[model samples]
Target: MHPSQSQSCTAFDGHRLIASGPLREVAAATKQAIDAGAKGPVLVFDDQTSLPVEIDFRGGVDDVLSRLGLASAAADAAPRGPGRPRLGVVAREVTLLPRHWEWLAAQAGGASATLRRLVEDARRGEQDRALRAGEALDRFMQAMAGDLPHYE
Candidate 1:
């Protein structure tokens, strides 16, 4: 999936946070730092997922931005397929038990709509999201800060 302007990222020089903002901005900052011969082991990460971001910074800043923009362009240029392209609905297989299928069939909307509603309802709780973010952050910390004193 292509990231939007709201998709923020952070760049770190070892354990220190050097840049934090939109992907393009952070990438520019990172490229500049690396070009200026900053210390080794600089990395970038997605703030939402707490996952390391892999960016190819081989070219100039404009080229870097162009590469990042291409993803957005490609996603937007994708040919519309079946199943409500305007609504951004993608069709994927769902293997359910016969009873579950029967229940979905009995719902007011079709199986897809009903399943979407059920999933939305289930995801309505902030607790689930908070827990997931915490877990992701924990994983990132364990990978990046495990060697630090009393990281736990």
Candidate 2:
């Protein structure tokens, strides 16, 4: 799935991971944890994007489920066609030294294909990068986010 289209979230109770899956599942799990009086705070983050997801389980399971269902149904209502969306590739000036351009020109598939390959390889390694970033964000929250109002 495209990163932008993903709704998968991971719920963390303090340093330990509680649940990782769809929004509804994570929210339910988080609710249970909160109701059971879990330690510290429960935070849910987008699995792929690493963005925070705020879930209000104060209204109980039905309210949370209804919200999740509405969100999914709204997304499903969007107009979509079979096959992947068009890859919006655009040309831009890339300034490179003479030898760099020469090497790219000498490659089997030329500069564009080489650039694409390089990007795909970097993207493939994003899971590790994202994990590091997520950890860093948690640390940041521990140090800096405490003073913020309504932190939990």
The residue-by-residue lDDT of candidate 2 on 2-54, one tens digit each, is: 22234887888876788988776677778778788889567777765566776
lDDT of the structure predicted as candidate 1: 0.77
TM-score of each: 0.61, 0.45
Clashes of each: 0, 0
Candidate 2 residues lying further than 4 Å off, grouped into runs, are: 1-6, 70-152
Model-by-model lDDT, in order?
0.77, 0.70
RMSD of each: 7.4, 9.9
The residue-by-residue lDDT of candidate 1 on 37-66, one tens digit each, is 878578787888877787778888777767
After superposition of all CA atoms, the RMSD between model 2 and the true structure is 9.9
Candidate with top lDDT is: 1
